[model samples]
Target: MKLKVVLRKAYDYVRYDLKEIAFPSSLPDPPHIKKRRKLTWEERYLVLKEASRLYAASWVRDIGPDLRPNDYKKYDDGEEKPNEVNGATKEKEPSTLEDLAIAARGGMETLKPALQRVYMTRASAYRDALKSFIEGYKEGVQQVMEKKENSGTQGEEDSPKKST
Candidate 1:
């Protein structure tokens, strides 16, 4: 719900910006797919592992851009057999789904009010922006519902959100 609203607001802003754009683009276009620094196997594994952990933690499944920055490790020893020591002596506490869920809920509860205040205190512009965003979202949803009602399919299985 929240991300959908955010994206719709972004789309609205883009359309508004395009309409208000001053000097038009004049530069020549660049290549379609710019090259990026290549990742090693260790980096790839770390990324996949972190994403898996985050997906498990998300109650509403709206984890935004990496809230934590990561560094790349150049090399990694290949996978090891279970219960075998390969010179790494540290042990980590194993967490289950229940533990992760509880932790995620705790994190959200602690962060929600602070996040609200962050928007509220930025400036008058930010305050009004947030209000307008919420109002616009409500109007859009109402219009969608009305259209759905007229179409005769109040499909509970259908939500307007785009799934990745």
Candidate 2:
């Protein structure tokens, strides 16, 4: 009903509904407010790397514990074992995407849930980029091999043999 109340209501509406508030005309820059800036190329790369590690760690955690490598334990008999019941150790589990996730989380002790979500959002795109890079590299290697094979055989055949 009063001007102050009306002004407060308008400010709330702009802050909440519109998700932004115009600075007062008198101040060119708001005091004590941090300016938001876009991440530079290097910063983005580091963020993506961190996010990927966290995301992978989450996946590794989700996979059943059985697939994860267990630490070797020594028994009273002075024998080491991976499984509890027998002294025999299991053959290493085959590596999977889950393994990659575990490796990515290798150094990190804890994951922040909010940051993990951001990483998860970027993970798919990063994965696609990596896949493309791998494919390109493979193609380049294959082409080099093909050229070597062709050139080696052709050069030998084209050369005149010296009679002994």
Q: By lDDT, who's the top model here?
A: 2
TM-score (C-alpha) between model 1 and the true structure: 0.20
TM-score winner:
2
> Candidate 2's residue-wise lDDT over 1-164, tens digit each?
99999999998898776663444435567787888898999999999988887667767634333344353333576665334455345555645444456655864543344347557868987999999999999999999999999999999999999999
**TM-score per candidate, chains pooled:** 0.20, 0.30
1-164 per-residue lDDT for model 1 (tens digits): 69999999899878776666754656655879676889999999999999888877665443333443233223446755333555766566544444445555779875566556545666767878999999999999999999988666646446575779
Error of model 1, residue 13, in angstroms? 59
Which clashing pairs does model 2 show?
A: none
| lDDT scores of the candidates, listed in order | 0.68, 0.70
